[model samples]
Target: MLKKDKERNDAFLAIGNIANSVKSAIAPYLDGVLIYVREGLSVQSRKRGSVNPVFDCISRLAVAVGQTLSKYMEALLDPIFACDLTPKLTQALVDMGFYIPPVKPTIQERLLDMLSMVLCGEPFKPLGAPQPNTLNSVPIIPKDAKDP
Candidate 1:
């Protein structure tokens, strides 16, 4: 059991630090991906001597997807950084597949699971460990609190 307050704090802090790093890395990396894909397609379009709707559509889609994902990561990381460690750990455990779901997880759920796996070690199987019914089901806390 999570007996020591210090241990809990340390675990939470370490995970928060990981979340912050993820937040820092995601934006630029996403932007770079968009830029690289767009530029490569642009060069190809130029080589072809005519506008390619396929390239244009793909570039637009990349920008839209990047922006959406960036916003979602920011949303996820905010609570991970500031909320009580109890909830964070609970959610992280669920994300890391410590628990089995009654239903299939959504795409966002899968992404969070991957993120949790990266931050935490391997997941405990539901049969091996007591499982939570849901993963990261905590309410979205708005960004009213100061950054740590």
Candidate 2:
């Protein structure tokens, strides 16, 4: 019912922080936490006080949940940016979980060697390698075969 109110953003964050503190214990109720958060940041709750707390709450929940927050990113971002999206707040959210660290280009490059071995069992050929030739279309000739 907290979502129905939309004005009690501070209260929503209070519950959110509690959820963060006992993360796994509240796993089943995580969606409700996000629901209230989204509601608090909704356009209807445009009060400066309400919006900022929601941002802080979002960042805290993100840190607590890690990549699990990624699934709700779209829902969270819409209302968040719809309110008072500042660079600092956005950065906080990204730092916590929005842009996962492993997906970064640096991480991929760092893992290229290990990933190649694990995924393909061998390194791929270089770009300069000659194009592979095919033999399926060629017919075999025997030494004893007479010419037509």
Candidate 3:
């Protein structure tokens, strides 16, 4: 059990590291966007509010960040699903009753669902509970669900 715990911890750390790395990579882009917005706002104020350049820049930056993070998250999900450590983690969660049956999804399914939830900025509700209002705009069903 000790060894299993260590493996689970390692896997969790690996996933966290990947998320941190992606965030770190985007930090410079975020900083540049902020600087541009600030400059634009200052210029607009000097020009007596005749221009709204800051909002445009902010919107573009937000879109770029969303796209980048979406790609990163999609890429991250596959490996996480395939990792040997995941099933063990899921089993442990189940054993502790953190994951309820009837609605118990496979490891891969759970991982994909989690990634989608995070990307959509939704709270991580377990499978059986009511999904939060934040997910109203995003589709929560699995892609494969439509087929079978």
Best by lDDT: 2
User: Model 1: runs farther than 4 Å from truth?
Assistant: 1-59, 62-105, 123-129, 132-148
TM-score ranking, best first: 2, 3, 1
What is the per-residue lDDT of model 3 for residues 1-148, given as tens digits with 9 covering 90 to 100?
1124344334334433443456445545554434433443343332443212323322333333443433233333343333333343344323322322322244346655666665776635556986556857677876786686
Candidate 1, 65-110: lDDT as tens digits:
3334433333233333232234323444244222222211442454
Ranking by lDDT: 2, 3, 1
Best by TM-score: 2
Q: Score every model by TM-score.
A: 0.18, 0.53, 0.23
**Where does candidate 1 have its weakest 10-residue lDDT segment?**
95-104
Pick by lDDT: 1 or 3, better one: 3
- For candidate 2, the TM-score is 0.53
lDDT, residue 81, candidate 1: 28
Would you give me the overall lDDT of model 2? 0.59
